[model samples]
Target: MEEIRKIIHIDMDAFFASVEQLDRPELRNKPIAVGGDGDRGVVAAASYEARKFGVRSAMSSKIAKKRCPQLIFVRGRHDRYKEVSKQIMNIFHEFTDLVEPLSIDEAFLDVTHNKKNLPSATLIAKEIKKRIKEVTGLTASAGISVNKFLAKIASDVNKPDGLFAIPPKDVEAFIEDLQIDKFYGVGKVTADKMHKLGIFKGKDLKKKSLLELSRLFGKHGAYYYNISRGIDERSVNPNRIRKSVGTEHTYQSDLIDTKEIKKDIQKTTQSLVRRLEKSDFKGRTITLKLKYSNFEQETRSRTLLQIIQGEEMIQKLAEDLLDQEELKTSIRLIGLTISNRINESEPMQLTIDF
Candidate 1:
């Protein structure tokens, strides 16, 4: 697999905020927040301006305002975002059919067997970035490597309209020097646990015996062990159909009241609806996800008669799902998702926002 695999990850820089700036010249070079502006609202995206003030995506709007009082909050335009996503995906198809979108702003493409027969992955990355900028008027970063893990890290190493590639020969040393927190599957919680175990960097992680790491971290421990050695066997799966699209966050405190859960569900529903609208994605199924204090996960879903949009409809459905479940524990996370099949006849539009 190593002999023929060539994976590239392309991530747009500050995607939503950049699009907002592009479509509205007045907003250019200004601090912008794309999402709800209300007290309970959370930022979906923040421009570089807002970021300088510590504003970030998923941070509460109230906190964002505290950080940057003059921040401009703009409602996200889903249709416009979907348009740009289509254009980028089309570009990926030009190189190879093995294209997997991680989200609206990022994707992985396998171009090892591209018709152009490009000799160097670096050249391919450069051409892809150029074409993306020419078509979308937005900057993107590209990372080229033999596998997904290395490619993803390489892309983030140089960002905001940059490209980087990790040759096969350099991969081992690269992984050895990488921070444990930078590993693909190591989230904040996991990173903290690693730190408690005296594992601060990849080299430290590599020192742990596989059996010992597995005993401490469960299945994920073994995964970290292999990654520390620069070994990843996952392939670039092109036919990866999105089974679901959802967003979830761990709260600083758990909530126990039914009313509070309802409010959280409503907020999550609104966010999901916005994403659905932007993607022009309508699903027959709606799902409600919950995480309890003990970290147990549960989900309830309902199949609808037709595709639906709007916060009211989604919130109502999510509420219905939640009402049917027994909440025996305090809630830590709440999420909503819409999925199933889509109507293929509706041609996805392409609009470069900024």
Candidate 2:
């Protein structure tokens, strides 16, 4: 018999916003956002107080302000965030070396073979949470289960300084009652498609055969089929390298003028550059994405001979990519991505469903 893998997922509560609040005591208990406040600005993170007003990450500053008139905007300090992340990750290592970071504020840790020789994953999760609060003065939520999929979902059950665990004996019943939308990979689009096909929840999804789901959702159908039955075989990998760092913005109004489009491109490129510098990522390929007002999307990519890191160089490349094609219609969105990283030659890792 295959032994169940004891996995734990840890996620900080509104990490960026929480950090801002932690550093600035005056911002505590107040609705705050960490991102730009200008017209082109997007919310990088929103406090729980802000979230009560339906504010969310990636929402336009304009809409977020409209939603929460009293929302406070603060610029993100990625350097500080990174420093805190390092502290949290080091704590995870004290318990186990099998820590796989999903982002700066969340990670998966496999404790089936932990260094501490602990028998209970739940106890470990609680201890970790306590340690994080003690060390960073911040709260984190933890989910522990038989595998990464279940663990990730369990973590969100009791969020904002909470811990939840799904044991092996209760896995089947627990999964059967889980909603399809709550499943690891089921996004809004996939959920709607599943609903149309009468697959609204795990029980509904479990009725479909592999062949049937494959025909409907392509390769992802197989994943949905297995996860619906409490099956996920992903292992925690500590050395997984990030594939790319990028950012995009959607305009409230369509941009028709070339000058306006170029300006937006420059702004987007600058944001991407900041992200690259924060992550210390270097890549040779620069890709520009454009979404037309009618929702038609196009991409242009260029690969340089050497690693590219400068803001001026990246902005120029993004603009050049924009000039390559004439606009057929007004553009509603613009994005820039840097990939084809230099010297990082590991095969792509499995997706950890957010």
Candidate 3:
């Protein structure tokens, strides 16, 4: 029999907001948000207090303010956050090198054979959370399970300085009771679709045959089928490569005129170029995405013979893509992504707050 892997998923609690509160005593216990407060500003992170008023990350600053009139907006200090993230990652390294960082604030650790040789992954998770609080004055939640899928879900169960463990025996039952939306890959839209198919929870999902699911959800149906049965074969990978780099923006108002749209595309391309320069990533495929005022979305892609790195080429390609599509409505969002990397052998490993 194969040995059950000991996987632990650790997620920081309101990471950016917590970090800001840690450094700034005045912001403690107050409804604070980390991001711009301007008309087009977006919430990068929100404190627990801000969340009470329905303020959330990625929400527009205008809406966030309306939700929480007293919400305090602080500029994001990404450098500080990254510095803290490094410290947290170093702590994870001390216990095990099988650490897979999902984001700056969260990671997955395979401690089935830890350097500490501690027999219990639960104890290791406790130690990690304790050390993070001591070093960064922040709290982290942990979920210990047999695989990455269950471990990630367990981490969010209690949240904010909490920890939960699912032993091999309880994995099936726990998953059966889990809500459909709680599954890793099921987003809001997907969950609604699943509900329509009478798959409101894991148990309901399990009733469907693999073929049935595949026929409904395409390729992702297999994943849903396996996970519903508490089976995820994916192993923790430490060296994950990023496959693409891109940037996008939501305009403060819908853009209708072609000249204005082209100008914004230029600015968006410039931003994407900056990101590409920062990450030093090169790709041959350029995809242009647009979401109209009515929320309808479309994407157009072109694969070039050579890698696209220069802003002139990217902007031209993006403009060409936009020109090719008919504008049925005004555009509210524009995104430019460069994927299919020059080196296609390795895949980038990267994800969410919870």
Candidate 4:
């Protein structure tokens, strides 16, 4: 026998832009975006007004403006956002300790057993939403369901200041009518593959057997099979930790010179070093990412016997990764990330048990 879980995913609406609007009274009811107002930078968030003009997060600021000439851009204040995040997270703690933050703006909370001893998760969601608005003057949309997958998707079903819940009884029908693109873990690339396989909706996805899905999707086949039927078993874990630390730069313009590229690598390495120092995280694997002029992306990584430390080793490996590959076109972006972090204090685990 198994127990059903009560999960709620809370996502702030256009967090960065909303913060901007909240702090600046004059900006309300106006189109605004938050990010670099430059040719190469990407939009981090778009106001509801900006969205009407087809502006969106991750769209280049240049194009975002082209979509809406009046789109006002503001630089992001991460510190201020983090401060507000702390306030809301405090509110979440008032309900349940099993709160797992997905990002700065989204989180999953397991309130099947909460501090308030609430009998209803929907009521809890409503209370949380009201409390957040009263405390931070920002709006958050919430989705309540039996599990993380459904709850996460449900959060987006409604827009800003919205609440949606999928009860156990309604889960199946709700999932069946859901479109394929709305399924968890399906992005543009995976959606294209699914569309080609004639899976345009949840019902279509359910038609495929696990064996067929596995053959097509490899390791994630079982995930799709389960999620398609409104089945997900992931628990809300509050103690999740970061696996990697990275920094990236979408260049102001494409870089054609190897010398200039190396300089950029050194600059990125310097920044990474500071972050690594701040977190005291050392990773054995260094991954280098590049985006060519055509927006084709490539990533290459190297693992070393020794944990990577200091700016010198970081720069050396970054340069080595670049040397291993020949640029097919002018590079538009570059990034450096490190993983395989060494947990010096954690005891080693046995490979087998008798």
Q: lDDT scores for all predictions?
A: 0.84, 0.88, 0.88, 0.88
Question: Mind giving the per-residue lDDT tens digits that candidate 4 earns over 306-342?
Answer: 7898767899999999999689899988999999988
Q: What lDDT score is found at residue 72 in candidate 1?
A: 98
Per residue, candidate 3 scores C-alpha lDDT tens digits across 72-113 of: 999877678879999999999999999988777889999999
| lDDT head-to-head 1 vs 4, winner | 4
| Candidate 3: 10-residue stretch with minimal lDDT | 344-353
- What's each prediction's TM-score? 0.84, 0.80, 0.78, 0.77
Q: Which residue pairs clash within candidate 1?
A: 19-354, 22-354, 78-278, 83-350, 83-351
Which regions of candidate 2 are displaced past 4 Å? 245-282, 288-299, 304-337, 342-354
Order of the predicted models by TM-score, top scorer first: 1, 2, 3, 4
Clashing pairs in 2: none
Could you tell me the TM-score of candidate 2?
Answer: 0.80
Model 3, position 48: C-alpha lDDT score: 97
For model 1, residues 208-284, the per-residue Cα lDDT tens digits are 99999999988887788888888888878877777666766566689888898887776677577656654456677
Candidate 2, residues 209-294, lDDT tens digits: the string is: 99999998888988988998888888899999988888887786899898998887766776786567556588888898889999
Cα TM-score of candidate 1: 0.84
Give the range of the ten consecutive residues with the poorest summed lDDT in model 2.
Answer: 344-353
Show where candidate 1 strays beyond 4 Å: 1-4, 249-281, 290-297, 308-312, 330-337, 344-354
lDDT for position 276 in model 2: 76
